[model samples]
Target: MSETVREKANQSLAMVEEVTAVVLPEPAAANAVVPLEKANKTQSAEIKRRMAEIDMEDTQSIVSFGSAAQAELQEISQAMLADVRNKDVGPAGDSLRSIVSTIRGFSVSELDVRRKRSWWEKLLGKAAPFAKFTAQFEKVQGQIDRITDNLLSHEHTLLKDIKSLDMLYEKTLQFYDELALYIAAGEAKLADLDATVIPAKEAEVSKAAEADQVMVAQELRDMRAARDDLERRVHDLKLTRQVTMQSLPSIRLVQENDKSLVTKINSTLVNTVPLWETQLAQAVTIQRSAEAANAVREANDLTNELLTSNAKNLRESNKMIRQEMERGVFDIEAVKQANADLIGTIEESLQIADEGKAKRAAAEKELQEMEANLRDTLAAAKAKKTGLGDTAGGAVPG
Candidate 1:
């Protein structure tokens, strides 16, 4: 045979060997075990071995159904007469005769089997059909098994590759989830600083607006302290952003590597798309979510800087209003103007904050929806993979 044909044949044989083998149950009694252990294994193995050797082309089997008036029937009658004083029927004889007829129907018939068979057929499932066709059906199936055995033999390299691919995906998801969680935490912190803590500190600055010479100095000092605290917090955020950003490229690279694995796993799914295509869906969904998250993070980063600057400006403006209020030259109209300015600042900042929140919420929801889909797809893939393995490895032999 040509190398290609030989390879194909080997592939087919490997499939059978990997996918199908009979296992015997433990013996019921100790004595039975001693007698039956090797015998049972040997018998089952022989059946499979014979099947593997079957030649579909130029193979033939014939079987003949016997007539009721065969030589065995007359011989049975003569043996019965010698055993009995009179010609008679007995329960034992009737049961024996029935058993004999049933056995003869299959065992004593001329062997019959098929001729040519495809390389894809299984040979061992034809035991019962030997009566109708012939044993060639079993023989063709055996050839198919032989071919399957070579391709799917023990230590299949493909299985190892699949496991390696699965490991890569596992790492990819871990990074995706970790990065998402870190960003979410940072967003929460930014929101807290912008909306609650910073605003309260600014309100404190405003309250101290009416200080005299010494008090005005004291108030300015407090304002500076608040600014310093907020600045430090902003600095910390920048540091965190640096760390997270640095890690992102590595994460993205890992995600990219996972794409190749997804391709390999999908090819393995073959016709079982509905069942085993989870990896493809998971990899695609995560990639999209990571992309969206990266975009959102970039936006939020700019917003963070804007918030820091705005807070600083608000603190300075507040300090100035305090100094004027304490100067006793505080006109009623001036106070009103200060209040109006404060309201304007609050409204604009609140709007920006709200928009940021809405965007983050929407992005998070999308991520969550995709996560649910990933789980469902993974389950289907696992089930389908299991089924494919079982079908090839668990077929019974003739």
Candidate 2:
């Protein structure tokens, strides 16, 4: 319960105590007897007046106070019933249920930083570990905002209900006080009828004539009936007052429930929400640190792999360089093979040259032979021509 409500309840209790102290006395004093005598006289006069006016046939008219009191009590009961009916807390209960459901729906696990990513997302460099968590955080923050608003609305409702219950509490107390007054008045009226009016009527009935006695006895009977009716009415009022007394605690209980709900709502808004937000922020920061550490670890591994590969390549290149530097520019085996090939080529050329020289010499010898034969044939032909020419000249001269 809120302090204000507690204080109001204390004040109400004190007021009730003060009122009770003033109204309920220990006993009547000796001086109070004079007022009692005067009250009895006044009651006798009132009873006489009522008897004079009341109809013998109509018993309802005999006790107007009881009828009025009963009517008033009924009215009070109906009004209280209406008030109790109107003060429905079903909506408040629903709001509380909704708030609880909203709270339950908030799961920190939804903000898991290690949520699985698709292969393509990783390959495309879109593996944002924080994106899902951030979205979930935003969604949860939105829920918190909605819950805060709902709690505020519920708090308002509870405060209003508490205030209304306070009024109802005061009203119930007032009804109780009124019922007490009614019961006391009815009891006093009944006492006056039994003590003063009925006895007087009985005495008159004995002294009067028979017909007058009959009338007096009828009035006396009416007075007794009115007294019975009033007694019943007072008992009913006491019962009504008992209901009001019971209602006081019921009203306080409802008021206390409202106050407690208000306190819960205020605590959620003031404490729980902020703490959750802070913790969520801390969780995000921790997750980011973990992601950074993982990234650094991956980078270190990549660097180590790159350095190892480069070292392997460097070792291979250095071995090749050392082999090249330790050897001459031309290999001795290659030079020796090249010289053998050159000598074979020169020998083959010399052999072809020798064969060509032999063939040319043979052809020259054949040409000389042909020339000598032609010279011999020319000499023989010349001798033969000279002889023929001499023989022809000799023949021509003869």
Candidate 3:
């Protein structure tokens, strides 16, 4: 073969090498199955402790220091929210924010009542954590959402670029075929020209083919550079996707934890606080009633003692008057008048004592009823506390 033909053949082989630049190896399945991060043991443990169902201890604290305990509870919820909010989304920030907007809305009421919580109020409080979790979940979910989009986008772009390169490879291969044929035909003409009178037209044709081969080589080099860039981008995108996907489970686990914690806080707020408040109020009321009843009983006893003394004194005076009459030294009219006044006074004293006794009995009975109610309330509160404490466990696993 002519030196020029040999050169052209070598150039065509180089273009073939450039064309292979566009072809990418299949990414390992292991890459897609990236190991996900687990929830932080410390954070998970803290969540369990803080969000545990309201127990007897919590109820006592709320009852003893209502506002202070509530403030502490609020601080915990706020801290959880803040912690989740502070997590870095890095390049996934935009995607995460967008996702959060579409999720369920979270709203916390700052309107905490200073007075005792009612049964209904406490029940409603249990839902508060849901709001907090919703807030946290939305934030994290948004990041996950963006991460997903990026993964898909990168994959799509990589696939599109690979397809473009494949088409280019085929076109370049065809060009190689045409250049080989031209080189062969040109070499044949050069050999024939050497044997006979050299022709300018044959020389020009060979020269033009050589020029075309040079241009084709440059095109192959440019395509090779482009394919190299595309491959690098694909590889980087795959890694990013894997990391992001792996990170997802960990984030989701945290979200699940947030949900669990919120549920517990709400339970404590609704069940423990309200029940404790009601129990305390009822106890106070019962005590007050008992005190009032005791006072009425004491007053009744004193009244009866005074009435008995007055009766005894009247009886003694009557006995003296009778003795005077018996001794024949008393006025009949004075004795009759004295007897009438004493009888009337005695009847009034007996009537007043009867009314006092009746009132004291009624007060005692009412006091007993109040005490009974208070006892029952306390028992119910205790049972609820025990039940809630037992039921509250760790957050549901993701």
Candidate 4:
């Protein structure tokens, strides 16, 4: 056998030893002890006995110890990959975002429960500000309930994913153990072929006559081919084992992620949702108290304005009444002043008449001058026309 093939076989044996140490620990009985060399010889004898049972004409049986192991590993791998591909935490994340958004959308200010009432509404006691707030609260509560339901649904899904990952993790370990056994068996068969079977066959080929030498050599060649094929199969199994080793940790990590998501969902459901609802209830109660206080303050302000306005009107009415009552119906001083005013008015009217007469005479004289100027201008224009006509008539021959 080549050094590379020997090294690979040694590596596979070491891996199998490690797996055996882990899976099947030694008994603690002090009297139960076996020599290492003796144990190895026993194992080699069993491997050789198994190999001997395989017909040289059919080498397939030599590597058929765990023929279905590869297919089983492939099935496990496909299942794990499908799970990894399908696992999604996006819905849970979306549920959390929606919860936050819904909580944010809820606002006491939007409810407008503290809006001031009109004068008529206040007088009739018809204001119902809290009605709208109650209606809006019910709507927001429904949204919160829906979000909680969605969160619970995601929680359930995450839990199921965790369980599925647990199964896959177990399946991977099972395959890992099986591959260890398969590799150990293949390595044992290869070692026996290289160390004992092939050398014996080569010796036979050298001693045989020319006619039988070719047949012996051909059998030796067939044995070597079978050994090569077994080696390649063992190497392929080791690769598959490595894949299972890698898959173990990957499965665990995915399970951890799912478990963490479940924890978050539980926290939100058990702690956050109840606390949020409590806070919301407290907020509504506080808002109602604030609205009541505001309404009282507004009423006080309206009363103050009415009182100030009525007092001002009363003072003005009393002052007018006192002034009217203190005055006489007709005083002598009032009659004398009225006679003086009548004389002054007549004299002023006479002075205005004289001024108007003088203004009319001046306006008549200006108008007569304007008419005289206009007649002179017309006479001059007619004389200029007649002179021009006579000059034209004298210039003509006929």
Each prediction's total of clashing residue pairs, residues at least 3 apart in sequence or on different chains, is 37, 0, 4, 0
* Top candidate, metric TM-score: 2
lDDT of 1 by residue, 270-385 (tens): 22222222433443355456556767888999999999999999999999999878875677889999999999999989998999999999999999999877765666666577
lDDT of each: 0.42, 0.62, 0.43, 0.69
Clash pairs, model 2 backbone: none
2 against 4, candidate with superior lDDT:
4
The estimated TM-scores of all candidates read: 0.19, 0.63, 0.30, 0.59
Compared with the true structure, what per-residue lDDT tens digits does model 3 show for residues 280-317?
Answer: 34544554565567679999999999999999999999
What TM-score does prediction 3 earn? 0.30
Mark the 10 consecutive residues where model 3 has the least summed lDDT.
30-39
- State the local distance difference test value for candidate 4: 0.69
1 or 2, which is superior by TM-score? 2
lDDT of 4 at 394: 40
- Name the top lDDT candidate: 4
After superposing candidate 2 on the true structure, give the runs of residues whose Cα lies further than 4 Å from its correct spot.
1-115, 118-129, 325-327, 337-398
Clashing pairs in model 4? Answer: none
Query: Over the stretch 1-398, how does candidate 4's per-residue lDDT look in tens digits?
Result: 22343343344334333322332211222222222233367654544554454454576675564567678878877887887777668888898888888788776665466566668878988646577567667777777777777776676666667766666677677767656656666666677678898999999999999999989999989988877877887787777777767777787777767776776766676668778878878878887887888889999999999999999999999999998898789776998999899999999999999999999999999899887777656656665787754444344233
lDDT of 3 at 86: 51
**Tens digit of lDDT per residue, candidate 2, span 38-92?**
4466644543443344442465644454345456546655655675576535665
